[model samples]
Every structure is written in structure tokens, then in C-alpha cells.
Target: MTLKHTILLFTILIALPMVSQDTSSSVSFWNILKSHCGKAYEGSLALPEEDESFGGKKLVMHVRACSENEIKIPFYVGDDKSRTWILTMNDGILTLKHDHRHEDGTEDDINFYGGTASNAGKKEIQFFPADVRTQQMIPDAATNVWWITLDDKTFTYNLKRLGTERIFKVVMDLTKPIALPEAPWGWVD
Candidate 1:
């Protein structure tokens, strides 16, 4: 009823939304990726390389599975559906892992290799450094670093070998989503 109490109440009401917005933006990178669930995007290789495995192939990524704690995006190269990028959030830390599988619904020997974000990234970008599992699986990849950027128009995945000259980058147009591709290898449904 008093002017001072009324002013304080108004200030608290105005500040509540700002606080929630700030928390959401801190995890916006993950939420942005999740927003594309059930949708697929086409992408192209951004780096020129001699590796023919990904050459002349239509690359597609489907935001196939999503949950509060994790998301699994299957990246398809032409007809090969053996790759899935898994993103997980645990106690504010975001982690990335590559899930590779065979056609017979079996896991590949060189699978589940990736890293965790070193800090709280921005709303549009997050970086991951190679984890211990990656180092043990591929010694040369010990210095690998991967980052993903998401925005209203584009979603880009990038990689770098800290001590080497190897780099891989893929940019997907988020503005133009494509048809969903087949289930990734090892996916039962």
C-alpha cells in the first residue's frame, strides 16, 4: 500500500523475467540445436581435403533424438548412416561424442570419442577439447578440438588438430531444413 513497498514490488516483478532470460541464454546453444528436433539439414564440407570418403556425397544431419539431458543427431553422408553426434549436459558442462556404428546394428571399435566443453560458452557457440578416451583410442587426436556454432541461419561444426594441420568443418543451412533421412546405422527404429 505504501509508495516505497509498491515501487519495490514493481521492481521485483520486472527483474524476474530478466533473470530467467539470462539463465536460458546461458544454455541457448543447446536449446537452439534441440529446436531442430525431427528436422534435417543439408550441409557441405567447408574445408578442402583429399579424403574422398566425404567427397561428392550429399551430407545430411537429422536432429533425431532429444531429451532434457541429451541430444543425438545422426549425420548422414550419402547412403552411409554410421555417424551420430551425441551432445549431453551434465551439471552445466556440455559434452560431445561421436557414435559410430556398423550396418548390423553393432558398435564400431573406434566409437564414442569426443570431449567436454571447458567453460560456459555463449548462446551461439561451444568448444570441446579431446577427452581421455579419445586420446587412448587415437593418440594423434589427443590434441583435437571441436566446436559448434548455432544461429538463426546456420549451424556449423568445426574441428582442429592442435598439433597438426588437419581440419574439418561443415556448415548447415538452418533456414532450409530438408527431409528426414533414414535411421542411422545401429538404430533399431
Candidate 2:
């Protein structure tokens, strides 16, 4: 191939990726969650300072979107069969409801409702406990229902939007530290 032709082709290849990157379709909150419907992510629940006295132990969250409106977060403490939690996120609110079933589907904990915010990523929402019934909750970190925002082209999940490109860090209190109870679902040579 001629040098000029090769150079032109290389430029196109590099520019093509940039063009695609700059023209990504705007992703919506609902759509983003929908795409992660059947996927589970291993995450740790942030713990407080050792001397803070929160006493929340480590755990592993089995986060899965059971349906379009429901995300089920099941967790186990260490490798014990005794301590477990079944947190349900319906619509946009979360409740620490108990699962009366074994991992194989046999009954266990008492079910109850709890308070959570419409946007879990909001700083103000994380600052204080919010009651769903009362019209009082954290203000919007940004416009729309997006729990996350794009800042300088980077995805910022937990933020309090003051304005464009301005955000406050969300201070989330840990109910428990979600540790890896087992190895990630898949790994093989």
C-alpha cells in the first residue's frame, strides 16, 4: 500500500473511535438499570471509621434486578448461614425486608418496610434518614431523575449537584460493610 493511503487509513481508524465516543447516545436512568436487569455486581458497603462506633460488620451484596421496578439486594455475613439480609428496592425506594427463605428457597427472616430516598445517589438523601410518606426528601442533585451525572465527560455516581459541573460528595452511612462472601461468579482458565 502507498504511504499516503496508509496514513489516510490510520487517521480514519483513530478518528472513527473519537467520533463514536463523542456521539454516544444519552443514557437514561431507567434504561441503564434495565440493561443491568439480570446482572449482579459485587460491591462493598462502605464502613465508618473504626472508632466511630457504627458497629456495621462486613457483608457481600448480591444485587440483582428482579424486575423493571424491583431490585433485590441479598447479602450474607461472612460465610455463615445464620446472618442474612434481603433488601428490596421497589421503584426508587429501598426497604430492608427480610427473606424467609434459604438460598435454596426455604423461609427465614421477618419482612418489614423501611425508609429510603427516591434517588439513592443523592448527597442530601444520604445525609439523613428520609421518610417516603412525608413530602420531605433531599433536593435534586441535578435536573431530571438521573441518580448519576456526567461531569467533564466522566460518570459521577454519588453527587449533589449545585449546578453544571458542580457537585457535592454524597456521604453515605453504611448499614454494613459488604465484603466478598465468595469469589466473583465466574473465573476459569
Candidate 3:
């Protein structure tokens, strides 16, 4: 081979491993959740004190929509379809937001309240503290901390309202996915 061709081939070989390493090391919790796209799971309240609104109701979570940058999971509490948990990844950070809607396809007054991950969390868990929007939307929740845990068998959504006796948690069985439910409120199809 000519000297110029040999140099170009060597340069390509040296750069390929770097590119692969970057991709492998960059996998985050977002990627793990995205893998279960199009699946739905049933979960139960993990905390002793349940919110009256969600108590005695069937709780379901459907990883309904997924893309490179976002995953929208509709959380169904009985027949109510007004809640969707949206997780978005941008510039290596992940943010969680709650999208609430009314039956008539109108946005709820208390909506889009969540926070971003503070650091590079593990592929199995992430913690999001209350952001400014969350604080403004609910003053008592200013000190709230939300977390999600994912594993081979289960996925858990948890919350703790700091400085108070408030906690909410739901653990979903990931191993056995259920049939998909209807679209969430305000969503077509």
C-alpha cells in the first residue's frame, strides 16, 4: 500500500475505538427506560398512607411514547387518564415532568411540575429534586425529592416531601407487561 493510504487506514483504526467507548460509557437511565417502550405494567402503592384520590384504584403505567430525546409514560389511576410522566434527556441531563390534562383535552392548572437529575446517575436509578417550577406550583413541595429505580424485575417511582411526613411510592412489575390502555387525555390515538 502507498504511504498516504497506510497513514489514513491507521488513523481510522485509532479513532474507531474512541467512538465506541464514548457510546458505551454514555448509556444512562434514559436508555434503560426507553428499552421498554410500547409496554405497560401494573403497580401498587408502596407507601402506607395513600392519597385518597389514588387509593382503592388500579394503577397502571404505559411507556407509550419514546424517542431519542424523550419518553412519555401515561400513568393511569383507575379510569383516570389525566397524568403522563415525561422524561427528557438533553445535554446529558435528564428531567422529569408531569403532564396533566382534563377529559375535555384542556391542560390542568397544576401541571408540568418536576425536576432534573442533579448528576450523572446510574443506569438503574436517578434522583430529581424539586426545581423552581415545582416550587412555584406547590410551595409545600419545594423540598420534595423524586426518584426512579429500574431493574430487571421492577420499576419504582418514589417521592419524599422533605421536612414533612409525606411520601409516595409505586413499584411496577416490569417482568409481566400488560395490554396497553387507551391514550392519555389530550393525546390522539
Displacement of residue 189 (Cα, Å) in model 3 is 0.6
TM-scores of the models, in the order given: 0.85, 0.34, 0.84
Candidate 1 lands at a TM-score of 0.85
Q: Give the TM-score of candidate 3.
A: 0.84
| Candidate 3 Cα outliers beyond 4 Å, as residue runs | 1-26
Give one digit per residue, the lDDT tens place, for model 2 in 69-115.
Answer: 55444444444333222334444443333333454444443322233
What is the C-alpha lDDT profile of model 1 across 44-156, one tens digit per residue? Answer: 88875555888678989999999999999999988999999999987667999999999886999999999998777788888999999999999999999999999999988
Worst 10 residues of 3 by lDDT: 18-27
Best by TM-score: 1
Model 2 segments beyond 4 Å from truth? 1-31, 51-58, 81-110, 116-189
What's the lDDT of the predicted structure labeled candidate 2?
0.35
